[model samples]
Target: MPCTQKVTDDIVWVGGSDRRLALFENVFPLPDGISYNAYVILDEKTALMDTADAAIAERFLTNVEGALAGRKLDYLVVNHMEPDHCAMIGEIVRRYPEIKLVGNTKTFRFMEQFFDFPLQDRCITVKEGDTLTLGRHLLHFVMAPMVHWPEVMMSYDSTDKILFSADAFGTFGAFHGPIFADQINFQVRYVDEARRYYTNIVGKYGPQVQAVLKKATGLDIAILCPLHGPIWRKDLGWILDKYDKWSRYEPEEKGVVIAYGSMYGNTEAAAEELANLLAQKGVTALRLYDVSKTDSSYLISDLFRFSNFVLAAPTYNNGVYLPMNALLHDIAALNLQNRQYSLISNGSWAPISGKKMDEALNKLKGMQQVGETVQFRSSLKAEQLPQLKALAQAICDSLK
Candidate 1:
């Protein structure tokens, strides 16, 4: 059976969720699974917003056919050329032989590189502010280059006031029954995953996201139809505000995130102590994680959410701990910015992880060290309590 939902009188949600996938992009963990969203806009000339991943191709194709109800798919919009969204392009083209593919110039270029299908006259190349009409619906294309991808763009329906966002306001989670944001407890259920998705997958392209947000202000959007997760028909401003803050590289709240990598338990103990001390000092929003146990994507998400953080790691082969080293690399690579951080390094003989961690973090924009690097030999002793306490106080003070 074709499982789908109605977005409006003429628009139908023809997407499905995949819960068995272990990881998203074969990197980020998807414990709660993920959803791939596509919409079918039925008008005088029908159009598909985008396509689902190959993982759910059977179900997706069925849903599309069901929504079309024997009608022809006139236009297939390619908002983001990423494989997850573009995987069904070839299959869709096969199904709808006369369908015209809609995208920007770069979109067609990437398409040629990815598929061997003959485009011929199937391409409808558009640019920023381009409009495509399907009866009463007027779709205005907004070019969002590097808003995570070079060929990315968002389509706005002028008549329905719906914005077909590519990946801009997406999250990581599978929908059970409800597909609308207001239908679920979004803040409690999906906010963390949403942050993780944005910070890790799209964090590096803050400026480009900002550009898209600015362009979106011109449109009168009443519904947000992203390519993943839940659809937004209510509380539009709340999600938009989140995007505004995240794209500007601003912390969502005043807090501390302490991530530590330890071979044994020495570094973990120190991180816990710092977290405890900070919490006792009136810092309510505090999180501590073992880099070895928790995924770096989770750590990166919190790092973006909180204003302050502490990195603790023991030296390994004269370098920062392996997990912590990789986390730092991801953080730096993502261009995480405008935050304060502290460091704790440990080693049996030579404790240089602090210095190494400090150097790696300093390369990022607007990263300020909140306290002096706390270095300990072997394990933290009574004598080191004062230093840890001072570092904790520094982090707490910065939170204020």
Candidate 2:
């Protein structure tokens, strides 16, 4: 039996979810699994938007067949060349030999590199602003190069006012029931996973995302059908505004995030003291995490959400802690900017993690330090309470 849902009068969602996979891309942990989306449009000439992962190949093909309902498939549009969405391309071609594969020039090149299937003049190459007509519907191709992939593109349906975004507005978690964002409590259920997905996977290409967003402003888009997560039919402005802010590397809230890498609980204790002080000074929007315990993806997501952050770690072998070092590298590699940060370092003999951390953060574009570096020898001394209080005050002032 195929599990398919109606997207519109002429469009049907043939995507499925994979909840058994522990990690996404073999790197980021997927606590609730992930979803892969593909759509089938039943027009005069039936067309498939994309393909799903090989993990769910049987179910995906069944859904596509059910949606087609004995109609011959005419086209298979390839918006992204990533394997997660393109893994079943060869299978799709084999199943529907008469189907024409639609994509850009680079998309064909990547397809040739990935699969050994014979094309035999079954390719329909399109360029930016190219339009493909299917009876009453028209698809306008918009080039979105380097929006996480060099061959990524988007298709805008002039008839239905729908944008088939490749992975631009994708999220992580798999859907349990509803497929529309308005049908569920999206903010409380999936916002964190959405932020984590963008910040970790596609966060490095902010400028490219900005370019795509600018191109999108010209089209009157009513529905957003991404490669993952729920489709957007209502409150589209909320998600669009979030992408704008995130692409510009701007914070969403005036709050602080405290991340600590503690070996023997000293650095953790210091981080808690600072959090306490910040809360006492009316800084309520705060998040505290253990870098050694929590994944770097979540930390990066929170840092992107908040305006201020505090990093506290213990010196190890004359360098910053191992977990904290990795976190700092990710922050820099992601091109995060315009953030305010504070530092705390602890060492029994030589406390130099603060200096190392400063050097790491200084390499970024618009990172600003809010308070003096607080150094402690293995523990927070009685006299160091004043230093923590002063740092809290400084952070509070900067927030105002």
Candidate 3:
């Protein structure tokens, strides 16, 4: 249903929509659904970009058939080897018997591993900057290694000047009713999805992304056609700008994000006290978010905006609290740098959380520790004002 969206004169979006959420892998616990996007470029010779995941293979083929009418598919380019994007390759090859599967060596290697080398007979290996002609359309394949996967490359249509990025600009959530960047409030969804995608999938490959960006520097790109989400025909620089900022591991602003999850009122009070103290010290963008109530997106947004972080959690069986641990597991994927932080922990008897946090924070590069962390046995009482003030003062000093 979403394939009917217009991208350019010759390019059409033939992607698949996700009807049910928590269906990404049919295993992971996902509240929001995912979309598998594929495109068909009807040039003088028809070229259908990557096929959608197996779940939507039939619909994806339908859309392609609709676009081609009776025209034969000349090329089926495989950018990523991920099952979600590559599962329908065998079927596509079966339907379009004469279509050539274009990809780099790594792509074909993965193709062999997946479909048992049966489809390998129709494969075409391409290197970086390799050009393939489909009728009058000239497609240049740029090798994009480790943007998220090893066997990934992007195809550029010279005639239409459209960059068919494999998964570089993909995000979560489905686009069923509305398509295109201008059709919906992209900010509401894309911002969070981008952070999640980058942190989880693409954050580790910053240098490779930079390489792709550098390779694309001289090209005259009018539209960026990614494998997922609504097509970008307007404000193309917006997503690229976001990639630049995120890839640099840059935080949004100079502030502190005090996120905590507490079982009782003890941790909450400490967080509140620290928040007030930071506010009193003229920290403009200070925010205290409860991880139990807030979604991962808001947490990521706060983490993105602030340079300094402070966390409070109670120890559970020598480990951190569930919500706090969950947040840490999520943040570990970010791999952020130049971050200044402090900690507060509660154990009642055994105080392992403070040291655990210390080790965890130390593993993070460029994470500057301000001062001694404040460990509370039960709660902050009347006598710990000096300690609390010192903690606040240390955080304030780190901000400078």
Candidate 4:
């Protein structure tokens, strides 16, 4: 049985979710799984927007076929050339031999590299501001290069005021039943996953995202049809605001995210003590993560979310702990900036992890150190409690 949902009177969602996949892009962990979203427009000349992952290829094809209902697929829009969305492009061309593939020059360039299929005469090349009419609907092409991918582009439907965003407003969660953002508690359930998805996958392309957001400001968008996760038909500003802030490297909330690396729970104890002190000082939105246990993707997400950060780690062979070092390098690699951070380092022999951590953070842009670096000799002794309390007070003052 084919499962599908209607987005509008003439547009139907022909996407499917893959809950079995453990990781996305073979790097980011997907505990809630992920969704591969595609859409079909029923007009005089039918059009299909993107395709699903190969893991769900069979089920996705069934949904597309069911949605088409024997009608010919005249147009297949290639929004992003990423394999998750473009894996079945060859299969699509094989099924709809006469369907005109719509994409930009870069899109076709990547297509040839990814697939062996001959696309010489099958592709209809489009550029920025190019419009394609399919009966009552008109799609305006918008170039969004480097918005996570070089071949990424967006199609705007003037008829229904819908923006076929390639991957801008996407999240990392499988769709259970509802296919729209308004149908579920998006903020409570999907925001973290969405943040993780953006910060890890598309966070490095902040300037490109800002360029696309600037382009979108002139157009009137009522529905956001992304290549993954749920569709946006209501409270569009909620997600747009987040994108605006994230792309500009601005924190969404004034809070703290304490991430620590502990070999035998000493560093974690210090982190917990600071967290408790902050809580007692009325700091409510504190997030603490064990860097050894928690995935770096989630930490990166919180790093983008909160304005303040605290890193706790121990020295290993005169260097920063392995997991904490990895996290710090990940932060610098992502070009994270404009945030305040504090450090706590523990070592039985050499207490240089705090300085090492500070050096790692110094490589990033706009990273400000809060108070003094708290150093502990393997454990938080009574003497260091005052120093930890003072550091927590400094973090709280910065938040205020």
Local distance difference test scores for all models? 0.93, 0.94, 0.79, 0.94
N/CA/C clash count, model 3: 1
Candidate 1 CA-lDDT value: 0.93
**Rank list by TM-score:** 2, 1, 4, 3
Q: Summarize candidate 4's per-residue lDDT along 21-128 as a digit string, tens digits.
A: 998999999998999999999999999999989999999999999999999999999999999999999999999999999999999999999999888789899999
TM-score of each: 0.98, 0.99, 0.90, 0.98
Off by over 4 Å in 4: none
Worst 10 residues of 2 by lDDT: 177-186
Candidate 4 backbone clash number: 0
Residues 1-400, candidate 2: write the lDDT tens digits.
Answer: 8899999989999999999999999999999999999999999888899999999999999999999999989999999999999999999999899999999999999999999998769999999999989888999999999888999999999999999999989999998979999998888899999999999988999999999999999999999999999999999999999999999999999999999999989889999999998888888999999999999999999999999999999999999999999999999999889999999999899999999999999989899999899999999998998998899999999999
Error of 4 at 98 (Å): 1.1
Cα displacement (Å) at residue 292, model 2: 0.3
Candidate 2, TM-score vs. the true structure?
Answer: 0.99
